[model samples]
Target: MSSQRYELVFSEGPGTGEDTVVVAPTGLAGPGGHPVYEDATGIVRAEISDRGEVRVLATGGGQNAVRVVRVRPLP
Candidate 1:
């Protein structure tokens, strides 16, 4: 398993303006062949494309925003 991590930034969603969530690779791929990531609670699942396109598959309890403005790699 890779130790790669990512920061998912959400805009105009549940929390305050531009909420950022940290996610790690799930070692699984989505239907579009993109890597899937989930929050610590395993509720928010998203498939982020190479070009920084985020497709949210599942939101823990509808707490995630549909629009993810930015995705950045973590050091």
Candidate 2:
């Protein structure tokens, strides 16, 4: 596995919609053409690519307090 610094970003909905942006430091090509954030339990979340794009695959936790947890990449 490779590691590098990354930026996990979240943007809440305005009066219309909600979106998110994830910036990877090293521009690593992850699963499904875009980057992927996988947790310890092998749970993977959608990730943005080097380009600014957003894609939602899982049913997010809802419009409450959306959690945007950032983990320090192992060296």
Candidate 3:
């Protein structure tokens, strides 16, 4: 089985701004070398760029929570 790694980022807590997390991918990219996503959880949102950039959007209710997801291809 070929395993892959992904990066995650989110906003946690008040004034926390942006947080980061990493997740291992279960499957490879679908096409175009773009990251593939199956499912997402929590207030986490994922974004990817053709320039090999990943961005996540997660906002905490001024409490201090963070979650982020990023997907990338491996060589």
CA lDDT of 63 in candidate 3? 43
lDDT of each: 0.78, 0.42, 0.44
Candidate 3 structure quality by residue, lDDT tens digits, 1-75: 123544554554557666554544424453345554332443443344455465433335554433443344543
Tens-digit per-residue lDDT, 1-75, candidate 2: 234433344445445444433333324344567665533333334454445343433535553554443333344
In model 1, the Cα lDDT at residue 72 comes to: 85
- Residue 51 lDDT in candidate 3: 54
Instruction: Show model 2 residue runs off by greater than 4 Å.
Output: 1-3, 15-32, 39-44, 59-75
Q: Residue 67: error of model 3 in Å?
A: 9.5
Residue 47 C-alpha lDDT in model 1:
83
Cα RMSD (Å) between model 1 and the true structure? 3.9
Per-residue lDDT for 1-75 in model 1, tens only?
233788888787666588789988898888889999888988778887777777877654546445887888887
In terms of lDDT, model 3 sits at 0.44
Q: Is candidate 2 or candidate 3 better by lDDT?
A: 3
| Candidate topping lDDT | 1
The residue-level lDDT of candidate 2 at 68 comes to 47
Q: Count of backbone clashes for each model? A: 0, 0, 5
Worst 10 residues of 3 by lDDT: 37-46
Per-prediction TM-score: 0.76, 0.31, 0.32
